[model samples]
Target: MSATAAERQFDELASLYEDVAPWPFRRDIEVPSVLHSLGDLTRSDVLDFGCGAGLSSRLLAGRGARRVVGHDASEGMLSAARQREAKEQRGIEYVSRLTPELEQRFDLVLAVCVLPYASTRSELRQMCASMARVLRPGGRLLALPLHPDHAPDPDYYAPYGLRLVSDTPHAEGGALRVELRAAGVEADVTAWYWSRNSIEEALRDAGFGPVFWADPWPPGLARVEDAPPALHAYLRRPHAAMLDCRRARVSG
Candidate 1:
């Protein structure tokens, strides 16, 4: 499969992404929130868009999803994911693009950190449309995009081993340089920022029903006040936001 400029960039970071599984933010905040948002997966067919090293794909399979298909544009990332699938034999099908047979085939689509990579509003809409295209009429999509209200301070997320820097923090489609660091490992990636209105408009135009932004709260905590002091700030200003919405069901 041919790679886009963004995909090629991810190809170089494939190894670093593997190490991301152990990052405190991913382990303690992001993953937990994502899993919580995706409540039961039994007998469900899921599409892991931007599967990236198959981390979330494996998690879905392990959670009892009947079938899991991982789709990605970066061959390097897919290679790492395929290698793990070969060893684990988890029955996941990894593909670079959706085929005719796969259209409207999934019950749910999980797009982790995928939408923010869209550098343009058109690209963002196309990404959302693709997710909608693969889902059954009433199927749902769970996505994580850069939080529209993230703190402007580049070092705000340094405690979580992440740093986001942008020349125009308020620009609707500004470039964001993301740095990930942990335990002697470091990687840099580029993403774009879109406001809540822009994101929701794209979803609606893509045939999705009402969009919901879920809080990325740590699991086992009833409220943000219940979180430890160290987590209060991050919880208030997470780097990414969770979005959930369903494809508009067919009308009679």
Candidate 2:
């Protein structure tokens, strides 16, 4: 599998990613919403698709997943993941791609902050297809793709150490080039913006059932206490969208 532009970008940033990703943002803002989407995973075989630095992979393993595997296209990211695995000894497996051997293996797959790097419709569809192939019958896929509406307001992402340098419109939706400053280093990352209809269509093409979009903050869950007051409103608007999809159960 050739490295995608997005994968290469992540590989370059892998070293600095963990340092800037605050626990408060992960536990308070991201995890809570993801957990609400995933009711329980006590014994499920989970796949952390595009598991950058294996953060979510560890999260799954810690949450009692029976088997947790992380797949990424970037060796730089995988290297970080391996280091964490060695330190934590969580027994999680880390691989480079969704190989054919993994077909119909996982009960739940989380591909957060992935997919948006597709940069093209074909790539988007192909990514979704890979997710479909890895899923067991009736398995669920939790997709966190770039939201169509991103950084609507000026200085929207500054509080999070990200600056929206450009938002260029495209046929698919748009391209967002963000300058992320973290750990005393800065990098520019470009992500493809996929529209809701396009994402849903891709999921259907990948043999998934109807796609369900989740609100950024589900009802009953309060805002992250540590989140900056300036970011609260933008968080409510969603820089990324959560999609819930399920593979069809094979009939006997």
Candidate 3:
């Protein structure tokens, strides 16, 4: 997880991120589990790092978060996010600058599919450090990463009898030329393939205690039901993870 690559790729694909994001339409694997893992917080200050399109930020605000500062490397996404926050009247502060503008502290830091894009260990470490720095001692951080063994192969995607193919690197999480007919849109997305172990170790190394994980989506409700038999079967098995963590204090 190298710094330069992840930032560069995110900056490149910021505009089209929302199209592939599981949003507005519907899905089971979503923010609830993420929220549940963090327990209840009424008016807690939150940070949505890599807050593309502001979906989760809006969700946090909708769920009684006092103030959610959205941070990302993509100006295009942040531009869209600002408009969205204005539309929702959510009073969210959106920042396109990652490290400098994110100097302020918060009650919680959410790293949603943000770190898997890191190309080197140092970049991944920085992402965790960013989350740690923003916390108010005893603050929480929620991070998600695709399970390595089940990581989505860039060459394969099976929809209801329609298969999507890409020459893009598998590490990108099949983001480019990404058209999901079932999901009903397209994009030049930038994503990543990462192991849960890699993600958890990074979090722990940054001084956060690991807490919880995400449940696989319920099929009857999401595209799982609509997916071809093979895909549906695969969906039932857990292929991703969400980690809940609390930043720790140094021993005196």
TM-score of each: 0.96, 0.90, 0.74
lDDT of 2 by residue, 146-247 (tens): 666665553666666666655453347467776776457577788777888898888889989988886566436455444666446556665667888899
Instruction: Residues 1-252, candidate 3: write the lDDT tens digits.
Output: 223544654554544556555542124344445656656658688998888778778877878888888988766667788887777788888886555545547888987767666656667777787778778778888776654544245334443212323354344333323334445544333445545666777788878886566554443445676754654544564444666779886567
Off by over 4 Å in 3: 1-5, 8-15, 21-26, 98-104, 151-157, 160-184, 188-190, 211-214, 217-235
Model 2, runs deviating above 4 Å: 23-25, 167-173, 182-185, 218-231
Clashes per prediction? 0, 0, 7
Best by TM-score: 1
lDDT string for model 1 (1-252, tens) is 356686678886777877878876778788998898898999799999999899999999999999999999998889999999999999999998887889899999999999888889988898899899999999999998888999999999988788899888768999999988767778888999899999999999999999999768767888778876778789888888899999999999
Better of 1 and 3 by lDDT: 1
RMSD to native for every prediction? 1.3, 2.5, 4.9
- Give the local distance difference test score of model 3: 0.63
Candidate 3 has a TM-score of 0.74
By summed lDDT, the worst window of 10 consecutive residues in model 2 runs over 164-173
Ten contiguous residues minimizing lDDT sum, candidate 1: 1-10
